[model samples]
Target: MARKKASPEDKIIDAALKLALAQGWRDLALADIAAEAKIGLPELAHIFHSKADILAAFERRIDAEVLAAAETEGIESESPRDRLFDVLMLRFDALGPRKPALKRIALDLAGDPMGALSLIRPALQSLGWMLEAAGIDSSGLRGAIRVRGLALVWAAAFRVWLNDGEDQARTMAELDKRLRQAEEWKDALSRLRTRKTDDAAA
Candidate 1:
């Protein structure tokens, strides 16, 4: 969908993303974004309190979109691995077309989350619900730990997907590795719980 630049807020966010893509965030300024959007600084400020505010808006906007898409992945395949594969593929499809800007947004996550926990914590809750719905054992798994693990999976898989240049073959290969690693991580976490239980008994 073409971004609507109808409102001052929309225009500013669009401009920031475009400028970030072209010249990097370091090269972007509130004035530059205002100029790109053909709005005045005062106008931009009226719509968004600050440049950081605009970035938070952009990050949050896409975060909601990607999270919804991740949730709506209708993959009832026999395995969670297959479901994960389908989810990752859907995100790639959605993000791949957006081109220049969304990819840059993905890269900026590490540097400027604005409220990473605010976004990701909810996503983790949703994913955990899905996992329980799928009959994945949640016993002994703390939501915070699960959330962090899931975030790592997302961040690592994103790095693999973003830089992949091999017609998606490499991307799928990377996804597969991540999937296997997830299983191993799950096992390790389960063992950690068991060892803690044994230490308590001892």
Candidate 2:
């Protein structure tokens, strides 16, 4: 029995993560990652142009994992909110082992507004996948609104998760609470819109 070899992209991302964890991303260089990954500079460069590219790839990897898990677990029977909860919880599970590095990245980005801003597109992309995994439509104006709202909710819950300690009980509680609030608001807005429609009809 032998361990399977990691792909070149995986190797580069792993090395970047390891280096980022050991020595913050700000101080990490492509040369260091190439060395850690045991690949030549050309090989590493072919896979990733910069640390940001590696990080983006890492985010996409996590999104793929969460989406795959959702398909395997089968969310067909669950309510929309429950499906979302399960999908997001699966995301945490995928990220569990990399918590330290993620936390460090979060902290570092907090001090760099531009860096944090750069993540907005990726964050929205991830939320779109999350919604789709939950059997929600992420299309059109309504879909855009849902994506933005969930992004905000997830961001707030993520902060709770970063400090959630080993058990993750707080993270679960916070996510549930936030989702509940969002659901309630959605219901209220629905009713309001219905009343407005009725008035317009009258």
Tens-place lDDT digits, model 1, residues 115-178: 3434554555544543444435434646556545655676666677777764777778877787
What tens digits encode model 2's per-residue C-alpha lDDT throughout 88-164? 98999999999899888887778878877777887888899999999999999999999999997899889999888
Q: In model 1, which range of ten residues has the least summed lDDT? A: 129-138
What local lDDT does model 1 show for residue 196?
100
Candidate 2 to native Cα RMSD, angstroms: 1.7
How high is each candidate's TM-score? 0.66, 0.92
- The pairs that clash in candidate 1 are none
- Candidate 1: list runs displaced more than 4 Å: 1-7, 49-52, 67-73, 102-141, 198-202
lDDT of each: 0.66, 0.88
